[model samples]
Target chain A: MKCYYHPDREAVAVCSVCGKPLCAECAQEYKGKVYCKECLAKVKEEEEVAASKSNVSKGDASKSGASEGVVPKSAVSEHTETSSTESKAKKEVPYKGASTAKVVFTSIVVALVIIGLILLSTMGISGVLTPLSLVTSKSSSVESVTAIPYEGERSITVSLDANNCMLNVKELENAIDDKVVKENTEGAKLAVLTSVNTASRMSYKNGTLTVKATGLKKNAVVNLYLTIRIKEVSLESDVKNASFSISLPDIPISAKLSLTNGGISLSNCTVDRINGTIMNGSVTIKNSGVTGIYLKGMNSQISFSDNKFLGNVSLNLLNGTLDVKGNKHIASFYEKGVNSVINCDFSKTEPPMSATFKNITTEVTINVGKQPAVISAPYADVKADSYFTVNGSNYTTPNYSKQYSCLDISVLPAGETAIPLGSITLLGGD
Target chain B: MSDIDARYMLGSILLSLGIVYILSNVTANFSPFWGFIGIFLIFEGSYYTVKYVFRQHKDITNPLVTLFLGIAVLIFTFHIVIPTFTMLVAGFSIAVGAALLLSGFVFKISRKEVLSGLILIGFGFLIATPAVFNISEKFYRYLHIYGVGALLILLGLVLMIPRNKKSVKKDEGGKSDEVH
Candidate 1:
């Protein structure tokens, strides 16, 4: 069987004290005694506590003897046994206590080591563990220093397979420049920056821009910077590991931006159909306008703020946050995911603001401008304002789904929204 | 090596670090297959510590401390125990370094101990440096699989040489294994 401590390794022996299986690397021996690391630590702690207690008792015994002018029988006997056995043990095991200075010095070393490790651990956790933590900081940052001139191109598609890239779609430039600034780490021998169209397999036709920056070697951190004109852009990125900061201009066109293993920061754009696919990154759309929205991804956050959607909205998230706020208009909303959350707060929405949701072990909350005309959920534990009816009966608080098989909630004058067994809350209207 | 406490502590540290480093390299696609060999060296180091260096001593505090440290490193490295393993490691290292610096003043100061403590503090700072600042531009270019693999191989070779083979046969440090 695999070791109890290390799932990948075989167990060499069971700990003598704890009876837990241990790998060879995790086993410890103390002068012909075999034990697991945990047992050894416990034994060590007990011994220190015992030693300190003995010292205190001895001091007390000496003080009592001085005050009474007589040696305590128990103290004398114990002292004799300790001296004899300890002397014998010392010969068998030549363990000596270092000077006070040495002990202090070692302790200091150990303490420092711990402190240093803590700090480093924090850095690793923040940067490597949570790649989505950069969502808020880089929400609206459109660092577009170099923009490629577009000669009246009606539609454009750019594809990139890069280690790290920041491609921005801004206003049309006066001139087209293919020059790009490359940021590379020290051991980046295999990381190469090239135009995706010329990289053998990728192709780009007229009115298409493709750039690829790939780290040819493992653990190679490469950065590619590019700025292109905002048009009917379709971006398909298949990156091993990278981050994208893209900004589409105020133009009326359909746009599709997809990423594989990075985060996307899209800011200020108006599109007919905005289809964004984020496989292992976050989606941050700020102050943008879209008619149709389709987002699908996992292990990242999807956030929208101060946006207007004139068409349908479909979101599919596996395990992350879905936050939408300040949407003035949306035709219909359809969302489905597992271990996901949908938080929407719309101050104002056009007529027929309908939504359908399906989730498992999810949390969803919608704050609407007006109470919906129809709200129906069969298996969910809902808490809504008392202005509706459940299966033709007056809606009541502190109610369970078991009592009534059918349920329906309606506001005086609004739309209808339906949700499933997930934990969903609807709140709005005075 | 004959000092059991020292051996146990050193062995635990090396083993934990070796496993973590190898895993990181493998996941990052840096070392791949070659990383396994480094783990063997770490295992060998642990074996040496338990077999020859460790002994029943007057107190077991330091060795126990070391074991706990090993476990802590594993937690921070894998991030299994918590989210954001890297950040946890950074914070822990800084706290440990500061504690060590203060501990030096608690007891009689030994130059060797002081130096070791300082080095540990410095190493902790180094680990935390990348996230806190941007000093990695020059270092990333030279930090590929080959360099890490080579270093692991060197360490493994060194460990296999058996620093105190003669001392292992003898129970005491003063004994010589030479035959007249």
Candidate 2:
């Protein structure tokens, strides 16, 4: 028989209540019998009304019984006496199925919404990160690079002048040319200072090495490959629009590194005297130690960790970020910057350390170690979130002001230094 | 008003506004949902209006007219090939209309009352003519809104009233054929 709802489709079952032929999609089963959508809806409505009426009567009966201090059988009987002929007929033919059309339609809508969301997210991500691939492509090209093994320990002065190329320095028993790229762009030739591909030059003169590369076009890109190793070496570079990544072994060295429009990365080297400068790029110094260090930068970031400064460290930056962590010890740490942020964690410092950090229009945070010291920040708000002692009074929550600008705080009883012009936040106790 | 009346009134208003918003946002899309809500409002409104208004007075022309017109509008709006708005409205209008007509006969009403019911059925059939004859889209659209809106308002008014317990019991008694 054809379905009552869909005449084109065959009827899978007949609604027991309404006696209508129903297709599989429209058929609903309840109590072991098939029913159509309309019959199911009717049965549900009737059941709900009956149930609600019964509940109301039951509640009324209970309330009356409680007030009269006796059990009321009227409400109970009202529910039990619902054995009408019509209700009996409805109960007798209780086998029916629920409708599925609503379910199918809802599922289709939800699926479409999910698909649209996924497409939108993918398109948004690709649109934002489209041009980031040019900076990382072809950045490692080297030519005329030779390696000479070291015979004995000797002092070396390494000067690398890469005008538009990366400079890398490492420590080994031999010196090898760490040239990055050898590219030949159309209608542009490099002024090769040394006999090398692409006008890039490098020559060792009287224990002083100078490397230079020039001539660049707008659309022309060149990958500079510089992987050289010199033990006890001094590396210098005055580069414009070039980045550097230097990694050397633990050796005593004097180095002055300078760059104009690129970032610098230095790791795993111990220096006697090291000074560096950068413009418009970040500086990353990690896992290294120095006796006396002086560094300056403009529009760049400076991050360092896991090293010790035996003598003193002075760093100046303009519009930059300074992140330092895991220092062994420093005799004195001084920093000056403008429109920048200094985020430092000195929770692992040895005793008797003095630090001074000053900035303008900047936000600074210094997490101090377990040493007694005086913290002073005049023009900024200072709140002691942890327990500390100031002027012989111990406090867990203390406020500092002009009358009480100087604060002596420490987890341990040892006062040796002071810091000024930065918000100092102690680690943990909070 | 009682809390239950206030709740029901608020619910009706919110649901009506929600339905109208959904319809206005995308009239063509989600037609099934729209139709379902429209039929529900029609039936619920018709039932409450008829039950309460007729309970107070057995012979009231307003409720009878509303009942007849609501059913007729449902028949016209729905009546598709599937068990969509078409079947739902058809079954509801036919069942409710037949019940009222039979009740009228059982009560042995006046000639005017009988004629009123017959006229209601005739109007219902007439309303269905647009769909049957594939009339102008503009006429069909106008009929759809007026039909659904009228029923919804009538039902909303019904739900807004606080249901009296004794009145409900009288309705149940009337349904069991306790009175002619």
Candidate topping DockQ: 1
Name the weakest run of 10 consecutive residues (lDDT summed) in model 2 chain A: A128-137
Q: Model 1, stretches more than 4 Å misplaced?
A: A1-231, A252-261, A274-277, A371-373, A378-430, B1-180
**Model 1, B1-180: lDDT tens per residue?**
345446544654564466545344322211222223323332332343232223322222243324344434444333322313445665455444544444454433446545655776687666556534423322443456366987899999988885544333454766756532
Query: What does candidate 1's lDDT look like per residue over A321-384, in tens digits?
Result: 8887776666677666555666766545544566665543444565554444445455333224
Candidate 1 total steric clashes: 58
DockQ of the two-chain complex in candidate 1: 0.02
Task: Summarize candidate 2's per-residue lDDT along A369-403 as a digit string, tens digits.
Answer: 44454554442222344322223323233353423
lDDT of 2 at A240: 43
Candidate 2's docking class is incorrect
lDDT of each: 0.47, 0.48
* DockQ scores of the candidates: 0.02, 0.01
